[model samples]
Target: MFVGHAVFAFALVAGAAAVRGVDSSRALSLGAVAAAFAAAPDVDMAYALVGVVSAQTTDALSVASQFWQTGNLVHRAMTHSVVLAPVVAVAAALWLRGRRLRRRRELVAAGALLASVVAIAAVVSGGLGLLIMALFVAVAVGIAEGTERLTDLGSRETFSTALVGLVSHPFGDLFTGLPPAMLYPFDATLLADRLSFSVDPTLNLLGAFGLELLTIWLALLVSLSLFGYSLRDAVDGRAALGAGYAVSVLLIPAPTLELSYPFVFSVLAVGMVGAAPRVGIRSRRVELPDRIAALCTGLAAVSIAGFAYTVAYLVA
Candidate 1:
C-alpha cells in the first residue's frame, strides 16, 4: 500500500480524536506523524524513480511490472515494522527540531505542508517515498512535543495522544493491505495482496476531490439535525465533531469505498476536527472499545494469513 493510504487512515482516526478534543492538538499532530511513519518504508525506490541533476521520466516499469516490482521493495520489509517505527519516529523528531518556529500551531501547519509536498513528489517521481512520509511525521511530533515542552500546553496529554497515534498507525495499514515488517528476523513475509490495482487510482482521485464535496454535504445535514436536540445547545461542539466522525467512519463500509477509505476518511476526519464541538469533545470520545479493537485485529491477522495462503496455493 502507498503511504498516502495509511497516512489518510491514521489522519482520520487521529484527527477525529483531536476534533473531539480527546487529545486534540496532540492527536492532530500525531496524525501527521503517523502519516510520515507509514510513508517511511518506501523510500528506497527513490533512486530508480526520482531524478536529480536533470528532469527524467519515471516510467521504468509498466503498470503490471510496477505492481510486481513493488513486492520486491515496497511491501512489508525493512521499512514496515514495529522495530523501525520508533527508530524512524525519533530520527524524524530530531531532524524537525531544527525547523522549530516559536508557535506550535505554526509548526503543525508547516509539518502538514511539508508532508503533502513529499507525498505528491513520491506519487509523481516514485522513489523511496515513504522516507519523505517518515520525515513528515517526525516533524509533526517534534513540533508538538517541542512546543508542549517549551510552551504552556500540558505535556502528559500531548505525549500520550502522540503515542496513541503512533500505535494505531500499523493497524490501519494492515486493513489497507500494507502490513509493516515489524518482526523481520522471526517473520520474513511482506504483504498479502487482497486489493485490486483499479482501487488505487480510483481511491486517489476520489480522496483528493471527493472528500471535499462530501464534507460540505455532511456538515450541513449535521448542523440541521442538531437544531432539535435540547442537549444540542449545550453539546453543540461535540455534536458537530460527532457528526464529522460519523461521516468519516460511515464512508468505511461503502461498496465503492475500497483503497480510498483511509484518504476519504482522513479528509472528512480533518474537517470534523475543524467542526469539532468546543465543549469536552475529548471526554465524550468514540472508540471501538478494547475488546472489539483486539478482536478486529485478530480477525485481520487471520485474513492476511488466509490471503497469503490462497495466493501461494494458486501460484504453486
Candidate 2:
C-alpha cells in the first residue's frame, strides 16, 4: 500500500490534469476538492496521529486508563464504514463550508456535493473495492461542478476520471497493515493481512532513498536512450521517472512504507507535476541536483548506523 499510495497520488495529479484539459478551471478546482474529500477517511486519526491530527491531542485523548480497551478509536470505527463514507463526506464538506462561511446556503450546496460522492462511490465500486473509492471522487467532483462559477466537466467524464483516482487509495492502503474498509458495512475486515505493522524505519529510509534515485536515474536513462532527449527535457521524462520511482517505493519495507508512504508519494507526485518541464523529455537537458544525491547518501549512512547500533545494543 505504501507504493500503492504513491501511485494514487500520481493518479490524482494526472486526473486533475485531465480534468483541466476537458473542463473549466472551476471544475478542476472541484477535482482538487474531490481529491481532498477522498482523503477524509483518514481524518478519524486526526485526534490521534501526528500528521492527520496531532500527537499531543492523541496523547490527551488516550490518556485515560481505559484507552487501551478503546478498540483503536481511530483505526477501526465509524471512519472505516462504507455507509459512513457519505455521512463523513457530507459532514466534512458542510463543516468546512460552515467554518469558512456563516451562510447557510453555502453549507447546503457543500452538503449536496458530499452526498453525491457517496452515491458515486457505492455504484462505482461495482463490486471492485478499489474502484468504489474512485467513484467517491468522481461524484464529489461532479457534484461540486454543479456549483461551479466557471466551468465543469460533463458528469460522465468527471465521473470516469474520478474513478481512476479513487480506486488507487484503497489499493495503496492494502500494502499498509490497515486497508480501507471499502465495503465497510458489508465487509468488516477490509484489506488482506499480507503486511504487518503500519510503521517501519528501514522501509522509510529505503523509500526516501529509492524514490530519489530512480527518479533521477530515469531522467538520465531516457536522455541517454534517445537521440535528442536532453537533460533539459523535464516533461516527457516524468512518466519514466515515475515508473522508476514506483519501483523504488515497492521495494521499501512494509512497515516503513506505511509510515513514510503519504509524505513521500505526495511530494513525488507534486514534484513530478511541477518539475515536468524541467524533467520532461520535451525540455532541454539539465544536470541532476547533487543535493538529492547527498540526501540519499546521508539517509543510507544513518540507516546503517541505526541498524548497527540496534544490533549492538541488543547483543550487549
Candidate 3:
C-alpha cells in the first residue's frame, strides 16, 4: 500500500487544489509534495529490514513474518498518530510562516514542536526508533521547505495539504493488519479491528486488494484529467487482453494477505501488455500521455479479471 498511499494523496491534494483555483500543472506539483509527505509516515518500516536481515531464514513467508514482527514494534506508534500529524502540520506552518516574516520566535517554537515529536517517539519506541522518526519529521519539514522554495503556494496552503496527506495515511492500514494506534500515547484504541469486508480470509484479502485497485484507478482518472486528457481517449481497446490473467486462478495457490506475492505479481504483470510496441504503425511519436493511458487501461482490465476470479473462487 505504499504506492497506493502516494497515488491516493495525489488525487486528493491535486483535486482540492484545483477546486481552489490553482492551475492544473501547479496543483499536480502540490500533489507531488503531498504524496511524499503521505509516504513519510512509513519510515518506521525501515526497521523491518533489520529483522529480515537478522533472521537466518531463506523461506519467504518466514522472512516476511520476521519483518512484520520487528516492524510492528514501531510501525504504527508515534509516526502514525493523528496527534503527531497535527504537530507536524503546525510545525510546518510555523516554519514557513516564520521564514516569510523573519520572526525568530515563531521559528524557535516550530523547532521545539518538531523536536518534541522525536522525543515522544523515543519514549514510545526506543533509541534507534528516535532516529527513524526523526527521519519522518525531517521529511515532513523538508517537503515544506522544498515546497516554499519550489512553488508559488503559500504557507497556509502547504499546511492544509500536508495535514490531509499525513492524517489520511494511517486509515489505509485499517484493511491490512492491526489498525493503527490512532490515538497514540493517549492509551485509547478507537479503531482496533481491520475492516475485513468478508468472513473468509481469502475473500477478505481479495476485497482489500480490490479496494487498492479502485483507489489507484480513481487517482489515475483524476491524474489523467489534470494532464488534460480524458481517460476514454487515452485507453486503447487492446487492454481487453488483460482478461487472460484470469487463467492464474487455476495455476497459483489461493492467496491471503500474508502470502499474496504470487497473486499480486502475476496480476500486475498483466499491465505490461500496455508497454508492447505497436507493430507497423506509422505514427512513431512516443509520448507519456499516450503511454500512461495505455498502462491505466490495462490495469483496469486486469483488476476486473481479478475481481471475477475472486467471485468464482468464492462460489467454488
Candidate 4:
C-alpha cells in the first residue's frame, strides 16, 4: 500500500504534466515531488516507532500491538486530510519560490531538524534514541534534497504537481482499509467504508491484498506509458505471469501466520513455474529475454523463501 501510494501519485502527476505539454525531464521531476508528498503521510509511522521505544516493548507481538494502535490514530489522521494538500502546497511553494537560497534554506532546515529532535526527546527517550532519530531524519532530508537536485525541478513546479497527489491520497486510502478523515479537525468523521470486492473468504480470497496488487500494476503500467514504453518493453510477460501464480498463495485461507497445505503447495508451484525456462541465451548482448529470465529467477528465489518461511512457521 505504501509503494502503491507513491507509484500512483507519480503516474498520475506525470501523466497530467505530459498532457499539459511539459517536457519529459520536467515531468519526471514533478512526478517525483508528487510521489514524495503522497507518501509523506506515512511519516506518522515515526510516532508509532517512538511509542514502541518509549514503552520498551521488546516482544514482537507487543511491538506490533503498539505500532497498530498508534497507527489507528495517526495513519489517516490530519496529515492525510484534504485540507493538508493546499497547506503543504503553499509551504512547498514558499520554500522553493524565487531564486534558490541554498544557505538560508539549509539553516532553516537544520533548525527545524533540531526542533524535531528536541520534541521527540521530550516524548521518547533522550540520549541514544534521540540522536539516532535525528540522524535518520537528517539523512532522509539529505536524500530528498539530492533527488530534487538530480531532477533539476523548480519549487513552484514541484508544489503544483504535489497538490494533485496530496489531494488524491486520502481518497485512494478508501480502497484498502478505513477511509481517511478527509475533513479532519473540523470533522473527525470517516468519509466512507473501504471498497472491498468481497469480505467472505469463499467468495473472494484476494481481499485487500488483491486491490493492492491491482493498484501497483496499474500504477506501473501508467508510469510506463508516460515514459513512452510499451507493456512488453517495460515488463516481462513471463515474469508477470509467474508473479500472478505466486500471488495465489495469498488467496489460500490461513489463520494469520499459520500456513495451510494448499498454500504451501501453491508456493512450491509458483517457484517451479518461475524457475522454468522461458528464454534461450544466444548472444553476449543483454536482451529483454535475458532480463525476463533474470526476473523469473528472482521471483523463484522469493517464492522459495516464502516456502521456507511457511514451513518454519508451521513447525514452530
Candidate 5:
C-alpha cells in the first residue's frame, strides 16, 4: 500500500473537486495537497534506512526484512493516528498564513504553538518521534506551500482535504501488516489485526496486491473524468496483447513482495501496448489526452497481464 495511500487520496479529493464544479487545474492542485498529506505519514520510514545501511546489500528480500525490523520501532505510530491529523493540518496552515502583518504577539503565538506541538511529540514518542514529526511536517508544508503558490486554493480547502487524506490513509495499511496505530499517542486498539483475504498465504498476498492495483485504477479514472474522458476511451483492443505475458507464469519463480522483480518486470512490460497507438504522422505532436489514453490503456493491459499470470500460476 505504498503508493495506494496517495492514489486513494488523490482520487477522493480530485473526484470530489471535479464533481463540485471546481476547474481541473485547481482540483489537481488540491489533489496534490491531499496526496502529500497521505504520503507524509510514512516519513517515519527514514528510521528503517539504518537497517538497510547496516545490511549493506541491495537485495530486495534482505532490504525489506532489515527495513521492517527497524521501521517497526515507530512506523505506524503518532503520525498515522487520526488524532494527529487536525494538529498536523493546523501546523501546515500556519506556514500559509500571510505574514506582511507580522507582529511580536503573532510571531510569539506561532512559536508557542509550535513549541507545544513539539512538546507533545516528545511526550508521545521521544527524540526519534520529534525527528519523524519534523521530517513529516517539513515535507507536508513544503508541498502545501507549493500548492498555495501554484493555485488560488485557500486554507479552508486544504484543511478539509488534509483531514480526508490523512484520516483515510491508515485504513489502507490494514491489509499490509498489523492495523496502523489509529489511536496513537494513546494506548488503544482499533482493529487489532490485519485483514485477511484468504487462508492461504500466497492467495492472501495476491488479493492484497490486486487491491493495490484497484486503487491505482481508481485514481486514474478520477483523473480521466476531470480531463473530460472515459475509461472506455483509454483502453481498447490493444489491451488484449497483455494476455501474452501469462507465459512468464512458467518461466520464472513465483514472487512475493519480498522478491517481486520477476513478476513485476514481466507484468509491467505488458504496458508497451500503449505505445502501439501512435499519431498517423510522426511529425505531428501528440495531444495530452491521447498520451493519457495510452497510459490508461497500459494500466489496463497491466491489470490483464497480472490477472492472467495469477490465474495461470494458480491453476498450474
Candidate 6:
C-alpha cells in the first residue's frame, strides 16, 4: 500500500501537470516530488519496526503481528495529518530557497514532518526508539532527495508538488483502513470509516482479495496512462491467459498448506507475464512503450477473468 500511495500520487500530479501543458520533463519532476511526499507519512512505521526488533517474538507470524499492532497505534496519527503538510512544505522551501544543497530540503522536510512522532516515541519507547526513527527519517529524506534529483525539477516546483502530495495522501488511506486524523492536533477527528468489501474466509475470501488486486491494478493502469502508455501497449492477451492458468493451478486448495493462499496470485501472475516481452522472435529490441502496453493489456485480461471467477465461485 505504501508503493501504491506513491504511484497514485505520481499519477495525479504528473497527469494534472501534463494536462496543464507543462513539459513532460518538468511534469515528471513534479511527479517525483509528489511520490516522495506520498511516501513520507509511512516514516512512522519505523517505530513499529523498532518495536518488533526489540520484542522477543518466537515465530515469524508473531513478529509480523507485533509490528502490525505497534504500527496501528500511531500509523495515521500526526505524520499523516493534513495540517502538517504546509509546515513541512514551508520548511522545505526555506531550506531549499537559496542553497543548491541537493536534497537538504528533503531532509529538513522529513525532520519537520516526523518531529511529533520522534517526541512521542522518545517518551513512550525511549532514546533507542527515537534513534531508530531518526535513522528512518534520514533514509526517507535521502529517497526524497534522490527522487527530486532524478526528475531534475527545481526547488520551487518540487516544494509545490510535495505540498500537493502531502495534502492528498491522507485521503488514500481511507480505502484500506481507519481514516487518518486529517485535522490532527487541532481536532483529533477521523474523516471517515474505511471503505471495505466483505472478505470473510467463510463468506468470500476470493471476492475480498479480488477487490484488493483490482485496486492495485487500477493504480498501475493510472500510472501507465499518466506515463503516456495505453493498455494495448502493455498487455499481451496470450501471455495474460497463460499467467492466469499458472496462477489458477497454484491456487487449487491444498489442505496440507498452513497459510491461507488467496486468489490474488492470479492477478499478480497476469501482471508479471503481461509486462514481460512476448514469447516470440522479435525483429528488434522491444521498446519501452510496447513493453508497457503489453503488460497493461495482459493484466486487464487477467483481472477480468479473476473477477469473473470470484463472482462465479461466490454464487456457486
Error of 2 at 294 (Å): 15
RMSD of 6: 5.5
Clashes of 4: 0
The local lDDT score (0 to 100) that residue 144 gets in candidate 3 is 78
Find the 10 residues in a row with the least total lDDT in model 6: 254-263
Best by TM-score: 3
**C-alpha displacement of 9 in model 3, angstroms?**
2.2
Query: What TM-score does each of the candidates earn?
Result: 0.36, 0.39, 0.90, 0.63, 0.86, 0.70
Q: Write the per-residue lDDT of candidate 1 for residues 26-129, one digit (tens) a residue.
A: 44445444444444444444432333323333453243244434444545443444543443344334334434435565455545654654554366335654
lDDT of 2: 0.41
Global CA lDDT computed for model 5: 0.77
Per-residue lDDT of model 3, residues 1-316, tens digit only: 8787888898888887778888888888888878877888898898889999899989977888899889887787778889889889889878877877789987898899999988987887678768887988888778878877777777777788788889999998899988888787678997968888888778888988888887788788778778887777767676777666666778888888877878888888777766666654587665433567667777767776787678668666
* Residue-wise C-alpha lDDT for candidate 4, range 180-244, written one tens digit per residue: 87775444576567665555432222333344445555565555556676655433344434434
TM-score attained by model 3: 0.90
* Poorest lDDT segment (10 consecutive residues) of candidate 5: 98-107
Residue by residue across 76-186, what tens digits does model 2's lDDT show? Answer: 333345555545445444534443456677567656655554454455443332334434344454444442323343333333433443444454444434455666546
Between candidates 1 and 5, which one is better according to lDDT? Answer: 5
| Cα-based lDDT at residue 255, candidate 1 | 23
Model 5 residue runs over 4 Å out of place are 99-114, 256-262, 275-290
Candidate 3 lDDT for residue 75: 85
Residue 120 CA error for candidate 4 (Å)? 18
lDDT (CA) for every model shown? 0.41, 0.41, 0.81, 0.56, 0.77, 0.61
Model 6, position 216, has a per-residue lDDT of 58
Candidate 3 off by > 4 Å: 59-61, 99-104, 281-289
* Model 6 lDDT per residue over 1-316, tens place: 5666777777778778877988777777777678787888787777787669877966865776678778877687666767756766654554444234655655555466667655654664567546644554454456445654465566677568778877877886776557887776554576567654454442244444454455556556556655676655445555435423433534555211123233444345555554555443566666433655655666566666665555544554
Off by over 4 Å in 4: 50-66, 98-148, 188-192, 201-207, 226-228, 233-237, 240-316
